[model samples]
Target chain A: MARYATTPSQTVGPYLHIGLPWPDGPFAVAEGTPEGVWIRGVLYDGAGAPVPDGLIETWQADPEGRFDHPDDPRGAVARPGFRAFGRCPTDANGEYGIFTLKPGPVPGPGGTLQAPHIDVSVFARGMLHRTVTRVYFPEEAAANAADPVLSSVPEPERATLVARPAEDGYRFDIRLQGEDETVFFDV
Target chain B: MSTDPTTRPAPPAYARDAEVHPPLDYPGYRSTALRHPKRGLRLLPHLLTEVTGPLLGEDRISENDSDLTRQHDGEPQGQRIIVHGQVRDGDGRPVPHTLVEIWQANAGGRYRHTGDNWPCPLDPNFSGVGRTLTDDQGRYRFTTIRPGAYPWRNHDNAWRPAHIHFSLFGRAFTQRLVTQMYFPGDPLFFQDPMWNSIPDEKARERLVARFDYANTAPEWALAYEWDIVLRGREATVFEDEVDED
Candidate 1:
C-alpha cells in the first residue's frame, strides 16, 4: 500500500541580536525650564496591566500653533515660555507624563484651527506592530467637540481620547485593546 | 480504546538507507549560554552598546542627571510631553516579541542621569529610562514629562532643539534602526547640530510626526503617533563551512 510521510521540522535558530543601545537611561533632549500645560498618563495592555519599560514620544506646535524650528518658514515667533516637543518613557508601573504649554490654535491643512492636542506614538516588545493614540484635554470640550479629528470618530468613543483633569494637571489612560480602548488612528 | 484491525503502524521511510548512513543524533549540540537563567536578559546590555554607538558623537549630558534620583524640587515647572508609536514589519504587518528602549532629557532640558551636571533639578518621580516589549499587534507607548531644549558644545552659543531619541530592533541586526523624532514647531530645527546631521531630506522627514488633533486631549494632555517598519522574510544562504586545515 502507498503511504505519505511528513518531513522532519527544521529547527529555528536565534535571529541576529538586535537590542537598544543605552537600554537603561533617560532620553536626550534640550534642557529648559518647562512651561505650558501638561498631560500625564499610563499605558496598559489588553488585560489592563501596566506595561513597564515602554517608550512614548510626542511632537506638537507651540502655544500659538507655531513651530519652534527654523526649517518652518513661518519664522520663529516669540511665544514666551512655549516649548513645542517632548519625550519620555513609562515607569516601572507603565506610567508616563509630559509637561508643555497649552498649544494655540494652528491653521490645519485645510486652513482651520485644529483642536489643541498632542500627537503620540507608542513602542514596546511583543507587539508585531505599534499602536498610535492621541490625548485631548477635558477643558477644551468646545474646541474638541468641533475638532475635525474628533468629529471623525463616533460619539460614543470620543471620550476615550480626552484627558480628564487630575490634581497635578491632566491625566489620560491608553489601553492597547479591550473595553474603554483609547481612540487610535491610522496615520 | 480498541484499535481497528485495518489500521497498522507505518514503516520507516528511510529504513532501506539506514545501513549506509549510521543513525545520527544531535547530541552535544547545545550551547552553554542557554543553561544560565540570566543569560537571556543579559543580552540587552550588549545589544544596547552596538545600537547606540553611532549616535554617541552628539551625546551631551543633561543638567538634570545628577538629581534624577532625588525628590522633585519646586524650582521651575517643566513642560509635559508624550511619545507613542507602532512597530510594523516591512509589509506594515505588526511584529510582536520585540524590545524597545528610550532615553531623553527631562522637562528642564536635562536628563535624569548621564554623568552631566546642569543646573536643573531632577524630578524624583521621573527616571528618564524606560523599556517595553511590543504586544501581539506590534504596538508600544510611553508617557513622560516634556523634555526642554538645552544648550550644547556642538556650536558656539548653540542649543539643541527639543527632540526624542528613538532606538528600535526588528527581529535581527539587519533590521535594527536608530533615529530621533522632532517636534513640528521647534525653531531650533534649523540651528540644531544633530537634525542637520542627517543628509537625506526624505529620510529626515521620517523623524517628524504629523499633528493629529484627534489624538490630542485637553490642555493637561497631548498625543502623537508614529509607526516603524522592519524588513522580513528573507532566505539564509551559507556559502560553505570553514575548513580546519
Candidate 2:
C-alpha cells in the first residue's frame, strides 16, 4: 500500500478562540435567509461534561449540490449567495451555532447520492487531532434511508448521525464519550 | 478493538506511543464505541465541489485586529516580540492569502477567558487573541507578548509550556489546520505531555519557533519565526502556469 506522510493534528488547546473565530466566521449565510436554519449544538467531553471552549466547523454543498470551486470535476458552479462553509466557536455554555442553508445531496463513491448532510470537524483542548463526523438532516428521512454513507453506520447507532429537529433549526449534541457517544468517523 | 487510524497510515510524525494520544482513546480520550473509528469514515469525502473562499484582505484591516501584544490601553507585559513565518503546503510552497489566527495566555500564565480562574493577574492591555491573512508570499506576522507557562490538572503539578495557538484556513475546506508553536529553550518540554505527544522527535522540535536576529529590529521588538506545513496540496502549481495562454 502506498502512503503519504501528512502533518499530524494537535490539540486546539485552551486558547483555541485566539486563532479560530473571526468577526463574521460563524455564518455560512445570513441568518433568516429563506430556508436557512440554525444548526446549533453543545459539545461534551467523555465524563459527559460540556467542553466550553471547543471549535466546530462545518462544510456543505449548495441547494443544487453544486460547488463553487474548480476541483468539482463537474465545474466551479456556485449557487448565488451560498457560502457553503462556516465556523462556530463554542461559548462558555458549550454551545456552537451556525446559520446555513440545508445542504443538497452530493455524490457517494459509486454513483449513489449521499443524504443532505454536512461535514463536521471538532477541535478542543484535550484532543490532539480533530475528530470528523457527519450531521444528517432528520427531515430527509426518505433520502437518508437510501444514502450509501448512512447505511454503512450500524443500524442501531445510525440515529446518532441525524440531528434532532429543534424550534429554530436542528440540535445535535456531540458526545466525546460515555453513553450515546456521537459517532465519530476516521477520516 | 484497535484504536489506530486505519484509513491513512499513521503519519511518520505521530507520537511513538500507541495510546499516548489521549483524544483518540475514548474514556481516556472518551470511552465509547462511538468514539472508536468505524468503517463509515472510509466512504466520506472531505472535498466538496464548491468549498473555495474568496479573498480576505480586500477590505480595510484595522491595526487592533492583528496585533495582540498591546490591547486597549496598557501594553501586555513580557518580552515584546514579533512572530512571523510562511504557511506552506507539504511541498514547501507558500500558501498565500490564507487566514491565520492566534491566541495565547498573557505573560503571567493567565488567560483572559472566564473558564480560567487561576488567580493570575490579567494584563490590562492584552486580550491575547489576534489574526491576519498571509501575505502574497504566504507569510504572516504578528506582534504579541510571549505567553507564560500555566498550570493544568492533567497530572500532579502539570504546567503547560508557554506557547501560542495557531489556526489556519485555506480556500478549500479540507485545507484547514490548528497547531501550536512553542518558544525555543523552554525547560518544560520533557514534562509537558502535549509536547511529548508528537512521537517524532523532529516533529516535536518543529513546533518551536526560532530566534531570528536579522528580522528583529535594532531597537524595537525581538523576532521569532515558525513556519507551518499543511498536507496534500502542491503549493508550487502556480509557478509553472503560463498567463499568456
Top candidate (lDDT)? 2
Per-residue CA lDDT of candidate 2, range A1-187, in tens?
1022334456787666655676767778765588888889999876667878788888777777766665555656766556777788888888999889887877654456778888888887767767778899988998899887788788777888899999989998888776677777644
lDDT digits (tens) for residues A1-187 of candidate 1: 1111111111111110111223322212223444434577888876678866455655555666555433233444544444343456677798877766656554433333457776665655323123345666788878887766766678888888888888756887777655676666533
TM-score of each: 0.41, 0.82
Stretches off by above 4 angstroms in model 2 are: A1-7, A17-19, A78-81, B1-23, B26-61, B233-245
lDDT of 2 by residue, B1-245 (tens): 33321222111221122221234533322222233333323334343422343334534256776777555776777888899988876545678888777888998999887778897998888888887888889999998887899998776788889988887766555556677889999999888877776767777787889999989977878999988866544323234454432
- DockQ, structure candidate 1: 0.01
lDDT of the structure predicted as candidate 1: 0.49
User: Using TM-score as the measure, which candidate wins?
Assistant: 2
TM-score of chain A of 1: 0.75
Chain A fold similarity by TM-score, each prediction: 0.75, 0.94
Tens-place lDDT per residue, model 1, B218-240, is 78546667666554322223323
lDDT of each: 0.49, 0.71
